[model samples]
Target: MVQTTATRLKNRLRRTDGQLQGILKMVDEGRDCQDILTQLAAVRSSVERIMGVVVAENVKRCITDDQLDTDQQAQLEAALELVVKNH
Candidate 1:
């Protein structure tokens, strides 16, 4: 199960990487600035979503491990908040 989750996350990151490359190519081709910006925004959102998912998974693991103290939970929550706000 852990291996599956890692694989899925890796796939998500790879797809996001492709989108990033697409944005770079669009810029190189002198595509419409507005269109490029829109696509870039999408890429940013996709990365942010992936980050949120990874953070959630980490939080779940921490809780299950019984080793995550209050400070650790607070830190994770803060990280989650940052991702949510940025996304």
Candidate 2:
């Protein structure tokens, strides 16, 4: 079965949550700082990936949506440009 974007994002978020829990456990157990930092990096990357997915989906929507007025389309394009530049 093909998973929708929402489903994919939810799964990614769950994995990120699990990574965070593991980091907490590592801290409690006095695990190596390097190991904890590695996990933290992984979680950060996961979150970034989620953000990219969301932005890509929104961009696609903006391009394909035909009902948007000219002003709304311009606003969305500007907002998307800002997000891309900041990201």
Candidate 3:
């Protein structure tokens, strides 16, 4: 993975982790349902963004990596399929 992508993913993951902890605390403290749901939505969005980055990085590698041979095109296709199917 590219350094910038890795850093972005890590930062987003950390934010989501904090959001998850906050959600747990809210549940334990009996906070408002709407507030908790909002936070949870934020976490979901963060996770989706990270997933996008992962797929993008893989796609970039598939396009630019000189290490892959002609025979490895199938492998690249499979990887792309995984990313697309998941989405």
Candidate 4:
């Protein structure tokens, strides 16, 4: 079995996705508002962490290849900005 970083990230994201679906079902089932809100907040935090991992991975790849162009760097910054803004 070949274990890759991308595979790990993908697996983590899939688990998070399942958690999100369960949260949605809880909301639909009329669970307590406070509880649902807490779960939603957790989901947001998980997503942010995932995004950070992805960004770090990309930066690592770029650094390894010595190909971190200005445009790519700017795009990465913009993505970070969007994630922070939405959060």
- Ranking of all candidate structures by their lDDT, best first: 2, 1, 3, 4
Candidate 4 colliding pairs? none
Per-model tally of clashing residue pairs:
0, 0, 0, 0
Q: Which candidate is the best by TM-score?
A: 2
Lowest lDDT sum, 10 consecutive residues, model 3, at 78-87
Best by lDDT: 2
Compose the digit string of candidate 4's lDDT tens values, residues 1-87: 996978978887898898889888998899999898888888788788777767766765766334668788777767766654454
How are the candidates ranked when ordered by TM-score, highest leading?
A: 2, 1, 3, 4
Model 1 spans with C-alpha error above 4 angstroms:
1-3, 65-87
Candidate 1 whole-model C-alpha lDDT, 0 to 1: 0.80
TM-score of each: 0.68, 0.73, 0.67, 0.66
lDDT of 1 by residue, 3-87 (tens): 6768988998899899889989999999999999899888888888887777777766767536678888788778767775565
What does candidate 3's lDDT look like per residue over 6-87, in tens digits? 7877887888899999999999999999999899888877787678668867776758657678668678767666664455
Candidate 2 — which pairs collide? none
> RMSD per prediction, one decimal?
5.1, 5.4, 5.8, 6.2
Off by over 4 Å in 4: 65-87
Residue 64 of model 3 has an lDDT of: 60
lDDT of 1 at 37: 88
Given candidate 2, what's the lDDT at residue 55?
98
Q: Model 2, 7-78: lDDT tens per residue? A: 998998999999999999999999999999999998887887788778967886767668788898788777
For model 2, the superposed segments whose C-alpha errors exceed 4 Å read 65-87
